[model samples]
Target: MFYRYGRGDEPDLQPTKNWIRRVLLYGAYLDGTRYYYSPDVFLFFFSRLLEENPDSDIHQDTVPLPREHIQKRINADGDAMELAIRILACYSLGIRHKIDLTKQLSLQQEDGGWEIGYLCRTGKTGSRLVNRGYTIALAVNAVGALLTTRALSRNGILIDEGFVESNA
Candidate 1:
């Protein structure tokens, strides 16, 4: 996509914040894991970015300006879930990139969240911490992770008591 639209000044089509988050999530999970083509390159660059920009905000009123001098590396067949998780992690840890890469992998509300895709693929094997299935077990896990991170980064509560209190 970048190559066809590789103009140096081309404007990004989607929200920049989400892209930043997804790229970092992809990098973290790609690390130490074998990919179809080769190892993911962002593992190193993002590591350095995290190392150098430790003060980046996890939650605030404004998005942080990205540094102009980021290094690019090439790799193929990267893990998508890793990318989703890392975006969440960066958002939690304070990179503040806005793209919910998970949303891309997840089934749309129109699809009822049951169909299969890379997002539906299981990461678990041989008694891993996470499970492997398209069952509610998996869906709940993913939603739980997203909600947990979101709560941690902002509201700090899973369920809003105000809504429950008002209903009662």
Candidate 2:
């Protein structure tokens, strides 16, 4: 029961936009992630820092989940990588201040590493990429970013506010 997610199956990823976004977004380095999606952030970080929740515009329930199912480690229901991206995005964007980081934290394996279920289908062969090392690195990085953000808020460095409801 192999799913062939050829280039046609995947949304037209600009050369490799989705992959790039997935990595940065999932890594929780949102300042860097913003640059990938919109460059204006480079010049004006504060303006883009407080943007309308990305979730407000794009609802996960509406977007059809990718059919390119390979092997999942934690949740068998949805895309693991996508879940990471969503959680990190909400936290980093200051869009969902109440977003529970524990949502992603709960998926941690006994080994204390996260497994990336599905990264993205390769444009040429459509082979989904899920690297154990890569997953662990990014997941740890995302968690670090989240913790750091919370610390900043506690220190009164960042305003703790959210524009939308929790996606976690």
Candidate 3:
């Protein structure tokens, strides 16, 4: 809290801040308890970014690690949920660096819904990610956020904070 409110960016603190900041910020993942591959994990992080100042210099380096999980790890129906989470995370962080939505949107089914992505692995067992409404609703919300971001950008508006907070 002192760092957040005080002049922590002063020259006196720069060296210590740089060295210890990553250890502190990523400590949760380093503990070997938090699985970065989980959508719920990333969603929790994204939720925190909701209140972040757009101009704050928060390190977003760890953010893209989840994308690799979506790309290489998730092959089952879990893609929809995980991919949406990745999108939401990027949106919240205001990264906006050539974010390609095609890969995610392509997962939409012919019935205009999303398959039930793995909520969590039960362990050592494969389960068919059933087509369900919960996943579909989340997908819809994610897509809506993406579309709003695009439209805002086209109109010369920057979602520097995020779609939800920026639009509000």
Candidate 4:
């Protein structure tokens, strides 16, 4: 799907084309491990592909979520990491969102890490656990998104230069 779209060719299955395109373009998928859904992974891979194929038109046009759908998602207080990914995805695809970026920033914990609740299950009883790596990755990506869109500076949010360099 990624190659076909980069080549400006559509897949034969029209019905599944959108799904495949989204998965390749956004790295979004259901029922996957937390790592699989990381926005950093999506942005990194997508940007790499674009760099490798400068002539590709994949970035020329993008499929954005419906305005209503995006608004609904933004209004809901769902997973912070997931919401950050959605926000970044919309921003990247040139979708305009009226939602305040501060809401996302507010999700940051006092410990300087974003919570990514229940990244995995452990033990035979299946107790949910938080993964430090996942939390750090999510926080880094969320902040990266804010920086990419210039929201941090525009909103007068000051981040430590060292932190940004290390994460970035």
Candidate 5:
């Protein structure tokens, strides 16, 4: 949805803004701290939307996630994919902090892919682990986010120069 909007396509802004607000409001809590899933990805979209529509009512202040909260998560060894997302979010939001991009790079599997595991914690029940696929897709997004944020250099990942173009 955000990617489409970022590409200059028109998406209904109201619902997208509302949904982003809701996600920030009712997101998951880890280690007694709240975090939205795929935060960097969402931040990229949200920030792009705000940039494209400056007169829109949606403001960065309206976003519930704080820089400190995100920083704490980054410090806590959160999930690899989520961390990548957070890195992009931080970059988009102009929050500066040291994040070891190598950690995310190191998780790649021997087949040049990444695996996603579920940390399922149903209300009050103990968490269960489940391995899932579509790993290539997730890995691509993760890598893209890293590249977009410049966390990984050209030597680290072979990114096409035209992969992301500036709107300006």
Candidate 6:
């Protein structure tokens, strides 16, 4: 299906941002069999490298999956909160894929600090861990990524940690 993109042939066009997110979040990791986490790293790079193309017609020839197809990719029993969490996970992964670690770092909520796998599991109320639930490890990882990106962007000069913290 993707081969048609480079051939200059217009295939069916479908633009579903949520599905795109899911493909990047889940399908990218699938090895024609099962899913894995390695795709997260790949996605991080992919998203970071995305250009702001006003004239690009990449999606114009893309085939969009049906809602049922997207529905099957979900594993949280169709719960709205679960779906939201997955989408957030996709954003986190997508930002990383784009290699815009700064964006990933900024995605943190003001309520809680950084941690790894902050929203991986449910808490006391069968709800996923929220930012304010407590300081999780995933948040720390995300924050660290932010710090590193800032330092790099500043050309090895140390940025104000306080400034970074407040911005978060």
What does the lDDT come to for candidate 6? 0.36
lDDT of 5 by residue, 24-73 (tens): 55543332223223344345455555545544456544633544445555
User: Candidate 6 — which residues are off by over 4 angstroms?
Assistant: 1-135, 156-168
Model 4 scores a C-alpha lDDT of 0.48
TM-score of 2: 0.45
lDDT of 4 by residue, 100-159 (tens): 245556777798776764444554555666665675575566557656545554556743
State which candidate, 2 or 5, has the greater TM-score: 5
Q: Which regions in candidate 4 have their CA more than 4 angstroms from the true location?
A: 1-15, 18-68, 96-100, 118-130, 151-168
> Which candidate has the top score in lDDT?
3
Q: Which residue pairs show backbone clashes in model 1?
A: 17-97, 17-98, 17-99, 18-98, 18-99, 25-83, 25-86, 25-87, 26-83, 58-94
Ranking by TM-score: 3, 5, 4, 2, 1, 6
lDDT of 1 by residue, 1-168 (tens): 232344312455335535646545444343343221222223333443454444443112122322211112211223433344344334333333323334434433464443332332223432223223333333444355555555654665544331111110
In model 2, where is the ten-residue run with the lowest total lDDT? 65-74
lDDT of 2 by residue, 34-111 (tens): 222222122122212223222321213212211111111112233334445544444444333324345557778898
lDDT leaderboard ranking: 3, 5, 4, 2, 6, 1
Quantify all predictions' global Cα lDDT against the true fold.
0.35, 0.42, 0.51, 0.48, 0.49, 0.36
The clash count of every prediction, one per candidate, is 10, 0, 0, 0, 1, 20
TM-score of 5: 0.46
Question: In candidate 5, which residue pairs clash?
Answer: 40-85
Model 5 residue 15 CA deviation (Å) reads 16
Looking at model 1, report the run of 10 residues with the lowest lDDT sum. 66-75
Q: Which residue pairs in candidate 4 collide? A: none
Query: TM-score of the candidate numbered 3?
Result: 0.50
- Every model's Cα RMSD, please? 15.2, 13.8, 9.0, 9.2, 8.7, 12.9
Off by more than 4 A, model 2: 1-79, 97-100, 163-168
Per-residue lDDT of model 6, residues 78-147, tens digit only: 2222223333343332222222333444455565543333223333344434353333444454455555
Q: So what's the TM-score on candidate 4?
A: 0.46
